[model samples]
Target: MNPLISNALKKDLELYFSEDDLSRNLYYTASLPHDLVDCKLKLKDDLLLAGLPYFVEAFRYLGDTSLDWDYFKKFEGKTYKKDEKAEIHFQLPFAIALTGERIALNLLQHASSIATYTSKFAARAKDKGIAILDTRKTTPGHRSLEKYAVRVGGGYNHRLGQTDLWMIKDNHKSFFGGVKEAVEFFRSMKGFYTPIEVEVHNMSELEEVLSLGIRHIMLDNFSPEEVKRAVKLKPVGVSFEVSGGIRLSNLDDYLIKGLDAISVGALTNGAPNVDISLKYNR
Candidate 1:
C-alpha cells in the first residue's frame, strides 16, 4: 500500500474503533456465534469500484488477518451495475465481519462515488487534452483515500498538502502587496526551491507573474471567455491551469484549448456516496 494510504488507514481505523467502541458488538457478543462465516457484498448502486484496498485493510486492522482476498482483488477500479450480486466474496469471523462492515462499506462507498464522479469529468477533459485535477477540498482524515479514488477514476491530483507545491493564492498576493513581491519573497528563501504555482485573478495579475518568469499559473475563477483571452496571452513554455467554480454542468464551457488542467474541488467534496451493503451467506 502507498505510505499515504497506509498512514490514513491507520488513523481512520483508530478513529473508527474509538467511536464504534471495539468491545461492543451487542448482538454478536450476546448470542451470535463468533465462528468464521462467508460473506458477499451487494452493490446496490452502479459505481466504479474503489477503496477495496482500504476496505480490505480495515478488516486486517480489525484482526481478520488471514482472509482470502483473491476473489475481491480483481474488482478494484472496475465498474459494476446496480443490483450486482455474488461478485465480491470473502470470509472472516462473524464478529470481525460485523465489526468491520461499516468502516469498510463507508470507505468503499465514498471512494467509489468520488471515482465514479471523477471519471465523468476526466473523460470530457481527456477529449480536449486537458487533465482533470482534484483540489485539496477533501473530507477530513480521508484525503489519501479520496485522492486515490480520484486517480482510479482517471483524474490527476493537485497538491496533496501545502508542502507538495508552493501555490501563491490571492491572499498571499494581497498580503505581499502584489504577485511580484510574493514571488520574490519565496524565490529569496535559501534552500527552499520548489515548483511554484501562482493563482492570478485577472489578466493584469497574469501579466505581472509572467513578467517575473513564473511559468506555472492558475487562473482562479476565470470564465470561459476570460480564460481564452488569458490563454492567448500565454507565453511559450508556460502552463496554465484553471480552478474554482468549474463543475460537470459547465465543464464544457471551460475546456479551452490552451488550458493544461482544470482543477475541480467538487471531485472530492461534492461526490455523493454510492450505495453498497454486506450480507452474510447463511
Candidate 2:
C-alpha cells in the first residue's frame, strides 16, 4: 500500500470496527467451523473502477496477509459492467471478510463514482489540452483517496491542500478588505514557493491580478462570453481556470480557446455512489 493510503486507512480500521468488535471479531472468527472462505464482488451498475488499494488494505488489516498487491491491483483503474465479478474467487477468513465488507464496498463505490463522473468531463476536454481539476470540497478524511480516483478517471488534481497552493478566495478577500490587499499580503510574505492563483470575477479584477504577475487565475462563475473576453485580454503564459456551476452537461459551452483548466467541486461533492457489492459464496 502507498504510505499515504496506509496512513489514511489507519483511522479507517479504528472507525469501522469498534474496540469491542475488534476484540470480539477475532474470537468470533476463532469459533467458526471454517478457517477460510470464498467471496466475490459484483457491481450492479456499469462504472469506471477505482479503490482497490483500500480493499487490499482492509483485508490485510483484518488478518489476510498473503495478498499479492501487484496482482490484485489489476482490477483497479479498469471499467466493469453490471453483474461483473470484480473480485472473483478470493479467499479470506469469514469473520475478516464480514468485518471489512462495508468499508471495502464504501471505498469502491465512492471512488468509482467520482472517477466515473470525472471521466465524463475529462472526455469533453480531451483534445483541447484542458485539464479537469477537482476542488477542495471532498469528504473529510478521504481527500488523497478521492483525489487519486480523480486521476484514475483521467483528470488532474489542483492541490493536495492549502499548504501547497496559496489561493486567495472570496473569504480571504473579505477578511483582508479586498483582492488587491489579499494579493499584496500574500506577495509580501517570504518563502512562499508556489505561485498564487486568485479568484477573479470580472474584467477589471482579472486585469489587476494579471498586472500583479499572478500566473494562474480562476474565473469564478463566468459565462462563455465573459470567459472569451478574459481569454482575449489575458497575458500570454498565464493560465485561466474556470469554476462554479461547471458540469459535464454545460461544459462544452465554456471550452473557449486559452482556457487552461476547470475545477469542478461536484467531482467529489456531488458524485453519485456507483453500485458495487460483495457476497461470500454459500
Candidate 3:
C-alpha cells in the first residue's frame, strides 16, 4: 500500500472505531457472538473492483491478526460482471465479522461505483492521449478515497486541495470585482508557482483571459463548436480544458484537435453504488 494511503486509511479507521461515537458497530460489538466462522463476497451487479485494500484493512481491524484471513484480491480495479464471486477464508468470532460487514461493504461499494463511472470517461480519452480529470466536486470526507478510486479507473486527479493550484472562477471574479482584478490580487500575493487556471464563460471571457497570457484555460459550459474555435485561438503551448454538463455518450464529440482535457464533476459527486453482498458459510 502507498504510505500516504496507509496513513490516511489508519486515520479513517480511527473514526470508525471512535469511542465517543456509537454510529457504526460500537453498540453491536459490545455483545460479540464468540465463535469462529467463514464468509465470502459476492457481486450482484457488474462494476470495476475497487476498495479491496480498504476492505482488507477493515477486516484486519475486526478479526484477530493471528487467524487465517487469507484474502486473495486479484480482481481489484478490474471488471467483474454480474454473478461473479470471490471467496475469503477468515476465522473470526461470528459477531465480530458480522458487526463490521456494513461499514466495510459501504466503503467497497462507494469506491467501486466511482471507479466504474470514471472508467467510462477514461476509456474515451485513452486513444486520443487527452486527459480525463475529476473535479473537486466530491463527497466531503470521502474525497481522498474517491479520488483514489478515480485513479483506479484510469482517470487523473485534479487539485487535491485549494493550495495545490490557483484557480480563478466566476465567483472569485464576482467577489474580487473582475477577472483582471482577481488575477492581479492573486499575482501580488506572492505564493508558490502553482498552475493558474481561469474559467471562461464565453468568448469575451475567453479572449480577456487569453490576453492575460495564462497557460491553462477552462471553457466552462462551452459548446463543441465553440470549444473548437477557442482551441484555434489559444497560442502555442496553451492547455485548454472543457468542463460542465459533459456526459460519457457525448464526451467523444468534444475531443477535437488541440483540446487538452475534459473535466467531469460527476465522477465523484453522483456515481451510483455498486451492488455487493457478504455471504457466510453455514
Best by lDDT: 1
User: Once superposed on the true structure, which residue ranges of model 1 sit more than 4 Å away at CA?
Assistant: 1-8, 23-32, 83-86, 191-193
Candidates arranged by lDDT, highest first: 1, 2, 3
Instruction: Give residue 135's lDDT in candidate 2 (0 to 100).
Output: 85
TM-score of each: 0.91, 0.91, 0.89
Each candidate's lDDT (Cα)?
Answer: 0.85, 0.83, 0.81
- Quote model 2's TM-score: 0.91
Alpha-carbon runs more than 4 Å astray in model 3: 1-5, 17-28, 66-73, 83-91
Name the runs in model 2 displaced over 4 angstroms: 1-8, 16-34, 83-87
What TM-score does prediction 1 earn?
Answer: 0.91
Q: Which residue pairs come into collision in candidate 3? A: none
Question: For residues 1-282, what per-residue lDDT tens digits would candidate 3 score against the true structure?
Answer: 344644668878767656425457556657667676767777777789888877767666664453332344565777877865644355556765676677788888889999998998888788887889999998877887888899999999888998687889999999999999988878876776877889999999989999998889999999999998888898998999999999887998987888888999999987878888887753
lDDT of 2 by residue, 214-243 (tens): 899999999999999889887878999999
Q: Give Cα distance to truth, residue 36, candidate 3, Å.
A: 2.6
